[model samples]
Target: MQPIVHPVVGYLCYAGYVRASDGEAPQGELTVVAVFAAVLPDLIDQPLWLIGVTPVGRTVAHSLFGGALLVGAVGLLARRRGRTDIGVAFAIGYASHIAADIPWHVLAGDYHELGFLLWPVTGMPAYSGVKSLGTVGAVDITTLWLEAILFVAGAALWWNDGCPGVEVVRRYVG
Candidate 1:
C-alpha cells in the first residue's frame, strides 16, 4: 500500500467505528492522533531502514508484539489522563495500518511478506525488487486503482463527518 493510502484507510476505519458505536463522527485532537498513528509504523521503520539501522522496511515497529506494547502503553497513559478516546483512536489507526498491509498477501498465500509481523521471532523477508527508498517507484495498476477508490471513499466519509479537522488545519496553516 502507498503511504497516502494508509492514513485514508485508517480514518475511514476509525470514523466508521465511531459512527457505528457512538452514533457520531470522530473529530478534534483524537482524529489527529488517529491519522498520525495510521502512518506511525512506516514512519518509524522507513527511517530506520534508510539509515541502515535495520535491514528491512518492516522491523520492530511492524511486529505484533510492538503494536500490542504500544497500544497497551498508550491506552494506559491516556486512560490515566482521562482521554481513553484518544487511546482508542490511536489503536484503531495503528491496527488499521497493520490490517491494511495484509489480506492481499494472505489471499495470495505469500506469507513471507508477513514475517515482519512476528519480528525477531520470524525474520522479515527482504521485499522482492525493493532494495531502497530510491527504488520504490512503479506501483502496479491494480494498486493505483484501489488507492484511488479508497481515497474517494475516505474523502466522501470525511465530508459527511463535516470535515472535522479542517478548522485545525486552517488555524495552523493559515
Candidate 2:
C-alpha cells in the first residue's frame, strides 16, 4: 500500500469500528493513535532496510510478529495508564497496517514478498528493493490505481463521519 493509504485505511477502519460499536464519532486520541500505528511498520522497517539488516519493505516489521509486538507494547501501556480504549484502537490500526500490506503485495504480483509476513518463523530472503523513494510517489501503474481506490473509500468514510479533520488534529494529532 502507498504510505498515505496506510494511515487513511487505518483511520477509516477504526472510525467504522467505533461507529459500529456505539453512536459516538471517533475521538481525536484514537485517530492519532490509529494513524501512528498504521505507519509504524514502515517507520521501523524502512530505516532497518536502509541500513541493510532487513531485505526490503516487507521484512521484520511487516510481519505478524511485529504487529503483535506493537500491539502488546501499546496494550500494556494503555492498561497501565487505565486507557484500554486507546489500546484497542491502537491494535486495530496496527493490525490493519499488517493486514493492508498483504493484499498490496498480492496485487503487485509479489507473492514471495509475503514471506516477510511470517518473519522469524521463516528465514528472511534477500531481494533488491526500489532504489529510490521516488518510485512510490511516482506514477506507477499498480500503486497509483490501488491508492486511488483506497483514497476514495477513505475520503468517503471521513466525509460520512462529518469530516473530523482539523478537530482530530487540533485536539490530538498535534
Residue-pair clashes per prediction, in order, are 0, 0
lDDT of 1 by residue, 1-174 (tens): 678889999999989888899899988777878888999999999999999999998887789999899999999999999999989999999999999887656644577888888998998888653112222357434445666799899988888888877777777789
- Each model's RMSD to truth, in Å? 5.0, 5.0
List the lowest-lDDT window of 10 residues for candidate 1. 128-137
| Cα lDDT of model 2 by residue, 59-115, tens digit | 777888877777898899999999999898888888888887666556556677678
Q: Which candidate number maximizes lDDT?
A: 1
How does model 2 fare in lDDT? 0.77
TM-score each candidate. 0.86, 0.80
Q: Each model's C-alpha lDDT?
A: 0.83, 0.77
